[model samples]
Target: MLLKPITPCLWYDGQAKEAADYYVSIFPNSKITSVQKFNDSHKAVTDQDTGSVLTVAFELNGQPFVGLNGGPHFKFNEAVSFTIQCKDQAEIDYYWDKLGEGGDESKQRCGWLSDRFGVSWQVVPAALVELMVSSDPEKAKKTTAAMLQMKKFDIAALKAAGDS
Candidate 1:
C-alpha cells in the first residue's frame, strides 16, 4: 500500500549522496530512506564503477526527495525554483537564512530571494499574494508595477504604490 507520496528527484553530478545528506542535515524531520548503487547491469557507457551509488532517496523537512548521481550531462538553472509560501516574515527569514548559506542572494519583490545554490525562491507571504491580487484590479496592477522593479519583496512599498 502507498503510504507517503513520492517527492522530487534532483540530479547531481556524482554528488547525489553528498547533496542529499547535506539537505537532510539542514532541515529538521529529515533522513535518508534508501540507497542504490551502480552495477554491471547498468546502461551507461562511462559509469562502469563497481559500487557507485545510482540513486540516493531521502527526506527533507518531512518531504521525500530523490537524488541521482547522474554524470555531468546537465545542471540546475534559475528556470525552475521552489516557492515557499510563508505565513510571516520570520518563516521566510528562517528558510532564507538556511538556504542562503554558501549561496548568492538576489532579493526579489514580494519576498523572493535567490539562494546561493542558484535556485530562485519565492519567499512570498500568503497575505501579500492575496493583497497584491485582490478584487481591486487597479490596486493589484499598481502593486505589480512596483514589484517589477524590486528584488526583495517590500509589502509596504507595494501597498503604498497600490494606494497611489
Candidate 2:
C-alpha cells in the first residue's frame, strides 16, 4: 500500500495563527502553507468569529502540521509525545532551550521536555536509539536505565550505563 504522512493537527481556542507562526519561526525548513477560514456556511461559535480560521496548514523540518482554533474539547497530555533525535548533547541542549520557551520544565529520562506550546517532546540522541534498541538486551537495558535518570539525555551517560 502506498503511504503518506498525515500531519498532526493542534487545536487551539484562539491562538492557532500565533502558535503556527511561532513554531515556523523556531524550526528550520518550516512555513505556513495555507490559512483556511470558515465559509459563510458555518456560524461563529465563540467570541472570536467561528467562521474565520483558526485552521492553518504548516510544515516543520519537512513534516506537515495543522493548527485549528478549536474549542476546549481536547487537550495535550504526557501520553502523546513528539521525538526529536539529536546528533549530540549540545544539539539536545539547543532544542531544550529554544523549545522550552514559555513552557515548564521536567527533567525526565531520555531528554524529554514540554514546550511553551504545551507540546511534549522526547529529544532523544540518535545514537541512543541505536543503543537502546540494539540486539544486546543487557546493553539496551543499561541505556534505558541511563535515559530514565536524565531529562536531557547524555550520550556519555547512556554509554556508561551500558558499560556498567
Candidate 3:
C-alpha cells in the first residue's frame, strides 16, 4: 500500500510490526493498514533480514502512523510523544497501564510514560486540560500542582484540586 502523505513515522530497530500490532490491539478505531518488507535488492542499505518487515503503516484512534524497522542508528526519546486524550479516569487508567507495560517506570511521571518499544506517550484526561486552563487562576494552579505529582492522572483528584 502507498504511504500516507503526512503520517508520523516511528523509527524502531526491528519492532515495527510488533509495535503496530500492539497499538492496533489497544486503541479503538485502529488497525494495521499495510506492511512492507525489505528485499534482497535492498540488502546493502539496511541491516534487517531480506524478508523482514521494513515498514508498517497503521492508525491509532484514526491518526495515521508508520513504523519503520530502520536499524539502531536512531532512538526514540522524550522530545516526541503521542498524547491520548481520555474521557475519564477509567480511560486514563487503561491507556496508562497498557502503554506503560514493560516500560521504564522510573522515567514515567506526570501522565507521561515510555512504552516497551521506547515510544513516549501521554495518557491525559480530557477534563484535566480544562481545569489546568480554567479562568480561575487558583483552580488552574491547583490542577497543575495536582498533575505534577501524578503518574497516572486521577480525574477525581484533579476535580477536587480545581474545586479547592
The candidate that wins on lDDT is 3
Weakest lDDT window of 10 consecutive positions for candidate 1: 109-118
Evaluation by lDDT, superior candidate among 1 and 3: 3
Measured against the true structure, the TM-scores of the candidates, in listed sequence, are: 0.75, 0.82, 0.94
List, residue by residue over 1-164, the lDDT tens digit for candidate 2: 11137778887767788888888887789888889876655564455564677588888887888888877777767788888888888888878778876776753445777777677888777887686887788888878877777777778877888878
Q: Model 1 scores what on Cα lDDT? A: 0.71
User: How should the candidates be ordered by lDDT, best one leading?
Assistant: 3, 2, 1
The TM-score of predicted model 2 comes to 0.82
Model 3 spans with C-alpha error above 4 angstroms = none
- In candidate 2, where is summed lDDT lowest over 10 consecutive residues? 41-50
TM-score of 1: 0.75
Query: What does candidate 3's lDDT look like per residue over 60-162, in tens digits?
Result: 8888999999888999999999898898878998999998999989879999999999999999987666879988898899889998999888888888988
Better of 1 and 2 by TM-score: 2
For every candidate, C-alpha RMSD to the true structure in Å: 3.3, 3.5, 1.3
Q: Whole-model lDDT for model 2 versus the true structure?
A: 0.76
Runs of candidate 2 with Cα error greater than 4 angstroms are 1-5, 38-40, 44-47, 50-52, 107-109, 133-139
